[model samples]
Target chain A: MARTLITVPRTAKRDEIIEIRALVQHSMETGYRRSSDGDLLPRDLIRRFTCRFVPRVAANSNAASTAGDLIFAATFHAAIAANPYLSFNLRATTSGTLVFSWEGDNGLAQTETVSLLIA
Target chain B: MQPSTQALQKDDTQNPAMLWVKDGEALWNKPEGAAAKSCASCHGEISRMKSVATRYPAYSSTQRKVINLSQQVNLCRVTQQQASQWPADHESLLGLEAAIAKESRGLPISPPTQRQLADAQKHGEALFNQRVGQVDLSCRDCHETLAGKKLGGNVIPQGHATGYPIYRLEWQSVGSLQRRLRGCMTAVRAEPYTHGAKELIDLEAYLAKRAAGMKLESPGVRP
Candidate 1:
């Protein structure tokens, strides 16, 4: 499984361009890891990721538990790398915050927060 | 004192934690890679980090979440050591944690106290009791009810923190509370959680509460 380690600036000028990383620890078992019976494990991966910018960016991940604030979200299909890694560059132009999160076949949850400067 | 049970005896012989802890110990002293900043570079001395693991599973206000020792170490690697995470269950990760926990052995296992801790505990307890899958078993079924009974070829300990980040024979490596929980959920055919997650954080609160007052023994050897 890939652990998502996110990094963003502590403070950014309003509308300042910032970079973000979103990754997940996932076996991404493509119907693998079968038992002695040899049954397929079932396909699990980030299918696609949508990066939306509202207050910051709205990300709709096929794996996201919910949709909102999410600056970047993506669904990883079976082909995505194990512990899928995603990164983004966005402009922070408002007093709101930038949200970073990921979704996976296992479960769609795990988030890290970064505050945007209101300058 | 000669080791008693197979669990105890097994540890002295082929302890994965010991193996990883040794690596961690080595990493502590020998600096390598680009910048050549060994962990000891900023930490100074092992003795100085006294009781460090005891306060772990603590809240990281900077990151705005609760994190354990292993996660904290990984964070340092990315931000400070200029390294990346060694796979979720990677030996390097477990070993690094074990080495740190080994240092805190005997220090009290204290849970963190922040405004949100209580809420986290509430969420944790809820999740533990929620029955899932065909077995229709909640974590409480085995851990709370048949806690001491032998199941799946091993005596289920009280799930204490006295020997956390402990080496496990099954894993062939040291493991965190989150790792153990994920395995259990998968066993019951429930959806498992990721390495760093809210469920893990909540469960940390509940388990630490269960093991409160017990000394922390990082890099602990287990069967």
Candidate 2:
């Protein structure tokens, strides 16, 4: 629940679409476990996440959720490792910031914003 | 892929990441401590001490705490041999822990117990789901969302610890699972804890148990 990662590629070809992969640290506890004391541990996991991009090239060239949108959202399972990982693609653009965010099972959340540039 | 083929890809021990395992092995028996106590000097031939590494992050009633083998080893060095404890990411420590976990490949992961072990697990589970950092990403984000899907140029297989003490070419040496965990925390811009720290072990115990029924794969590899 406390760990996450964000990596924005240094450069991308204007026409080339590449995937951004990530993994986080969390137990994704299913609430089915008992501690050594035999008490139940509540279920907690990252429920969902999103990636977005906004154009910064020209002053008025903001990308819409439709065109430069990550558009892909994912739901992670509790059985996955701590710090679950994901990958999504973004359309190549001149310059922008790619935003990634996640919300977990027990109400935990995190977000990462990275700068991007396309030559 | 067929189930068997799928199984093979998921088996990290057999993956190319095992090069670090060999490195850890060389370091394990070599003597460099102040008291001349190599891991072999006290633990003996690790191959014969089956499963010791797999049951780590277990609770310790003697210390009223939960400790992993790495921390335990550090304790021994400081207390038993009058040597300074190595930092969690110290090459010798990571190499040794990775090697031990690697040796425990395919073994069972049983966490040690203490009076508060359950509470620790609960806290750790909460931490896993608790949101931190600006990323707002939880541990479940990738492993669960895209489990078994190819992501970021690699398969987002289940976040299982069949591999620990893995070899990351990126690290250029054996890496303790805690090291990877630390990487996660750092990426999220959270405060990083020392390797082999109790919090790290608790998280480790929780994840390994969650990954129960899966064979151990110490000294695993990943891109």
Candidate 3:
């Protein structure tokens, strides 16, 4: 699994705007540079990141609620430095799960889930 | 350092070097080598090794010489783990060093007071003052005499070794103090000593003494 760090509060007041930070380890090689041996380095990068919110559903509910609402997203480019870090704000309304995903070259896909309680 | 860069280093979430620290934590616990032992088997949790980085470039009785932390680490790999030594400045090695050094973050640098180590430090002091290379400049010339002066677009910093395994912006990666020292030698058109050389270890010893009492900021972000 790709090493990652995510910062989110465990609880927040209703309608409060909370900040969430996410960082992932990646080289994000641009493929432009050449090695000391003179060979071109292959491009490797984290291309996209997204966050989703899924409201808690009652137990025994037969709802196939797979996809969650998109909360934030960004598309990265070659210029992005190694170990990309991003922060965004979320309006807390209800208790739910936050899903974070990173997609990148070299089949790099990682997902992490965090639950936030709204009081 | 720019305020923005300082801000980056201040926030653990923003500092890229933390990634290596995290990886090092994992490596510390995970089993490896013929002995099927992890660092944790002998050292326990990484946090338990706190304040260890402060007294490095220490004298070694077994080797009858002064050694830096990296050399000590490699010695463990060879004698304890029965594993091959990690090549100089290898990513895995850097990760481990960064992780280990992070344990001592905020602690004062405290070089061990051993006769052998003190001798090494004296030797290193001579090296720091000796003029070399086509530039004919000693480390003291710029780091002491010309510190804070602009060289090209950058201001020279007072040479201190309070941080190692720092995340340098120029390299876009975490690097060791030896790497930085080698770069400085190259800048002055001097031939750098080989990694793990006694001269480099002596320099490390002197730097540790020079930076004594200063807080360590391993995995420091430098521009």
Candidate 4:
């Protein structure tokens, strides 16, 4: 499994834009490369990544909510180096959790989340 | 180096090595050793160490030899801090080295040029050009003659020591120049030198002199 690192501000003002950075540990093996034995190394890379912001809802509210709103997403390629890194900006509207997920070839997948407190 | 890797180096949040730097910062203030003297107790503010790393592999009158920053740190640990020496390439040692080097970032490489160091520097120059191992390749073969060319699908850099205690993506951790040099020896199938070996110290002297004008980028990121 690929290890991940995520960075998010611990606190932010309402409607403020905050930067989020993420990185994952992966070989990002491009099939174009050959091993010492002259055999082709199979391709393995994080093909996709997504970030979603799930706003905190009031406890008394009965509003229906799902997995949060998608804030950012990216599609990667084999050309990406090992340990893929991604960074983006998100506008904070309310206290919420940011969910980051990555998917790769050969069923490689990993997810991480961080909380953002708005004052 | 790839553009992406360079970008990672500039951004602390994205640079995995920063994690170690953070640990180093913590260790700096925290007391350790039998004397309970933390690095801060002696070194005071880290800012005082700025540009200190630029003049390493210097001649130590007491030791009667050239000593790199890592060795100096070990020396302090043993004598001043009253602590046992951390083994070579230990994470804690690398962390301290990274912290010290980080302070000197962007400074020029300026290893000492005293008369005492002349002989060791010559030995280092010879080692740099000498061919070794089954492949019979010398550091000059690639870093000098074949630099800017492809090697194993990656561009061969000038092999400057400008950035050390670097966070190498391959190793997925920060490491010292000696560790990287050992890796090079292994790549050429040569007998690797033990850490703190005189031969390695001599080679470091040569590299420091060769990279004299280059900027320091310790805790640098590389692919």
C-alpha TM-scores of all predictions: 0.60, 0.56, 0.96, 0.76
Q: Going through the candidates in order, what is the number of backbone clashes in each?
A: 23, 35, 0, 0
Candidate 1 C-alpha lDDT tens digits along B1-223: 1154234424422333455566677778766445678789989766666778887777787788777777888877777778766667676777677777777767888777786666777787887788976678888888778888888677776667567676554544457777788888888888887877788878777777767788775656555
Q: Write the per-residue lDDT of candidate 3 for residues B20-77, one digit (tens) a residue.
A: 8988888899887899889999998899989999999899999899998888888888
Off by over 4 Å in 1: A1-119, B1-16, B32-34
Which ten contiguous residues of candidate 2 chain A have the minimum total lDDT? A61-70
- TM-score evaluated only on chain B, model 2: 0.80
Listed in order, the DockQ scores are 0.01, 0.02, 0.71, 0.22
Q: Order of candidates by lDDT, top first?
A: 3, 4, 2, 1
- What are the TM values for chain B, all candidates? 0.86, 0.80, 0.98, 0.98
Please say which candidate is ahead in TM-score: 1 or 4. Answer: 4
